[model samples]
Target: MLDNYEDILTVNDLADMLKIGKNTAYQLINTGQIKSVKLGRIHRIPRQNVIDYIIEKSR
Candidate 1:
């Protein structure tokens, strides 16, 4: 479903991709499990961070 692995992802995007709830995705970001950058009120999650998180969890 991922068209571009290099593109940055929003919280909603991450949630949809992982098939998780929005709150859970936010929790992961808040807990620092998924790295993110804050832009004012918006959080931008790097594509690589999501990939890394998946890899870490798989191991």
Candidate 2:
């Protein structure tokens, strides 16, 4: 279930969860589709944000 994921997720984690490529994960963040926070040069995505993206796409 989505709730099983960590609160803060890395790009790789996002990719695994969504079954998407790493570039596609970056694209989602770059396109403002999935909200993320910057930690140095890394993007940390929230589980809720991913859930939101899922709901948005499902619509």
Candidate 3:
């Protein structure tokens, strides 16, 4: 469903998804463990990219 798709997820969204803290989410973003894109002054994590990164790392 289109509603099930989220192109960009915020830090809170990522934290909730990963069941971690906001600080941890920010740490992942900062440490490059999680992939993200910056729009203007905002940082957004692409859901697909995060999934892909996890999958790649798992392998």
Candidate 4:
């Protein structure tokens, strides 16, 4: 779906897609296991960064 190809994803969406908890997702972001961009007061995770992280960690 086109919607699934978004440039950025919310924390909730990340958890749903990765089958993880919000806390775990936050941990990943905070620990730099995943990349994120903070805009205003919101944190947005870029899709490409998540993909890259997955690939890097899978090795």
**Best model number under TM-score:** 2
Q: List the residue pairs that clash in candidate 4.
A: none
lDDT for model 4, please.
Answer: 0.84
lDDT of 1 by residue, 1-59 (tens): 56654489999999988999999999999999999999999999998899889999999
Better of 2 and 3 by lDDT: 2
lDDT of 2 at 54: 95
Cα-based lDDT for every prediction: 0.91, 0.93, 0.81, 0.84
Ranking by lDDT: 2, 1, 4, 3
What TM-score does candidate 1 reach?
A: 0.90
- TM-scores of all models? 0.90, 0.93, 0.75, 0.85
Q: Which consecutive 10 residues in model 1 have the weakest lDDT in total?
A: 1-10
What would the TM-score be for candidate 2 when compared with the true structure? Answer: 0.93
Worst 10 residues of 2 by lDDT: 1-10
Count of clashes in candidate 1: 0
In candidate 1, the residue pairs with backbone N, CA or C atoms under 3 Å apart (3 or more residues apart, or in different chains) clash, namely none
* Model 3: per-residue Cα lDDT at residue 10: 84
Write the residue-wise lDDT of candidate 3 on 1-59 in tens digits: 22354888888888877779999999999899898987887789988877876688889
